[model samples]
Target: MSAGLRVAGVDGCPRLADGSGGWIAVIIEPGNAMKAERIDRLAELVDRPEAPQIIAVDMPIGLPKRVGPNGRAPERLVRPRLGMRQSSVFSMPSRAAVYAALDPRLPDEAERYRHACSVARATSEPPRAVSRQAFHIFGKIAEIDGLLRERAALAGRIHECHPEVSFWAMNGETALDLAKKVKNAPHKPGLALRRRLLAAQGFAEALTSPLQARALKVGEDDLIDACAAAWTARRIAHGQAIGFPTPAERDGEGLPIQIQA
Candidate 1:
């Protein structure tokens, strides 16, 4: 593998429509297969390089500071829950937080909270069904918590897995914020650079095969997340490290974290 930064974009539970049911796609390079695999695959890919720089994911990496109403406000929030099994509810809040934290500007706390709530509502099944599903998959509510804890644990593991690689969670909000800033800026060399970034993302989509696209079905949100991840990776390759925001710190609108490598 080349010594240059190796970056991967992960989009999980990507939906095809407004309703429930979506798939996950891990786009390593343009036109790659959208295979269903563990997040560890990302780590594995980065490890191939002597010192991979970054791996950006679209899944949630943290839990809410406090649970919402309805037994866990975040849990109750995922929108379309039609065909989804109850077990998926366990991943909702963290996913929302992950998405929210990736954005640079969220407008305000209310916007951030609303966005989180909306994501939760969209991903979760009905309350009773989710409770039953959790029991079936985990044996009890406590077991569900265990699963959640494990998911959160990955935040620390990203660096450990590759040692040389840093991880970031990218979401739609961050992408939009970045785009706005880049697009609104006065005509300058930076505008061309921004367009190049978007072009790379589009190239990635075009390179993707029909079968892969069908399988991954990268949606609007997923595409934006992937673009942000790609942009972050590009920055890392150029010697910049991207930081993630904490749920409390995000006002729900601002520039995404820009970290130093």
Candidate 2:
């Protein structure tokens, strides 16, 4: 393994308004024991010689279509595998909806309807309810859009992934059904499951090390999620990672809309 080929995993702090809410990243070499860290700005953080050869993010990359209010193919393809926890996979609003949500004059419902309508009409998608929770991350989504559109080198290196999907792949192995994000499980069962899986892959330090723990800005779950994403990043670096849709669909700009886990 050369020093240049690194893999990274990233997760966003959901509620920040100014696009500086915070982001956590875990980096590991393809064949090394472990090399992980948390950072606030993902694009700027990895802009160097040691930048990841592959980056798997927990946010949506390719958005849904607006042809007719239809939802994103990636979310639709992945939901069944999650079973009762399908709620974890929300419909990605169309690019138009995202831009509309950013307008200062639009109220919450009006903006959401605008997004729903835009995605459906432009992409021929079915009208999917855009959740307020999903709308909240508009800022973070915008940040990634800026990165990909501007940086030609990062276009394919950074992939869209889901931590929930990754957790299922790690814990279940079969991919038919998998783990949950544990919204409020006692003793944090979801976190524990994710930690145990990463620990098995030599990432115990990423979870328990004092230095790493101090770097976690959000809650324990976010830290755990970043680690899970790193585990998936390892698989991606090793050519073992699998995508949700074998033949993924792409947005108008040609970015893939598949979840790799």
Candidate 3:
């Protein structure tokens, strides 16, 4: 990679003991060296002195006001491409529902979840509620959503990516046979399969190597996924990436809804 070019792959991490969960970024900089960093806010990573030119993050980016039976176009388009791994993509609800999940007035998590579901059911066709997995990342979804809304330029730099989608592209558009997690726990075979793909993409050993405390407060899967996201970021930077939809779609707020890899 050129010294002037910098890109990153970012993924959300589990909350630590003190309830501080943020984002993990695998940055590819000059000399093709990889650097891992923990950021409490996505903006922190974006505004750093050596900020990446492109950031591929594993999280939902656009939010629609009302979703149809197939959900958002991006989700609908990419799900089938993953085959058995399609379940990894969660159906996102309406913008109102996502915003409701972070309602400051509803301090109780259970209450907020119910309220968000109620809003989602009303805004979606065929009436669907927010899934627990989707609800859990609403904060992250909201974080990037709000930032993009506040500064439209970042939307051009920060793109939405899914690990499976990135890996699928890296694997010659073939979906992997294994699931990264089973019953909510890491699966070694699946993780190893992804590492091989990353290694082939020119990711350094520091990233594909065995897990260590190199980047604290994040799971092994988070690091791998981030690297996969970074792989897509590299493609994106080079104009070689493809969006889920042939042409990117947009939300009511004008944010691009396509997942690029």
Better of 1 and 2 by TM-score: 2
Reference-based lDDT, residue 257, model 2: 76
lDDT of 2 by residue, 65-113 (tens): 4633235777877777776667777777678777666766666766555
Indicate the residue-level lDDT of 110 in model 1: 53
Evaluated with TM-score, which candidate comes out highest? 3
| Residue-level lDDT tens digits of model 3 in 1-261 | 334579999999876777664888889885577878777888998898989989999999889989999789989999999999999999999989999999999999999999999999999999999889999999999999999999999998999999999999999999999988999998889988988888888876666655542447577788889899988888888889989886788999999999998
Tell me each candidate's TM-score.
0.35, 0.81, 0.95
Please give, for residues 1-261, the per-residue lDDT of candidate 1 as tens digits: 233434554444323455433323233432322222223234344446432345544333333433334433322432122122222335324334335423458756556555555555554443212222222222112222334354544332231010011111122222211221233343334223333444554434443333443445543333433444444544444444433221212112221211211
Range of the 10 consecutive residues with the lowest summed lDDT in candidate 1: 160-169
Error of 1 at 138 (Å): 14
Those runs of model 1 whose alpha carbons end farther than 4 Å from true positions after fitting are: 1-3, 14-23, 26-53, 64-197, 200-205, 208-212, 218-224, 234-261
Q: Quick one: best lDDT, which candidate?
A: 3
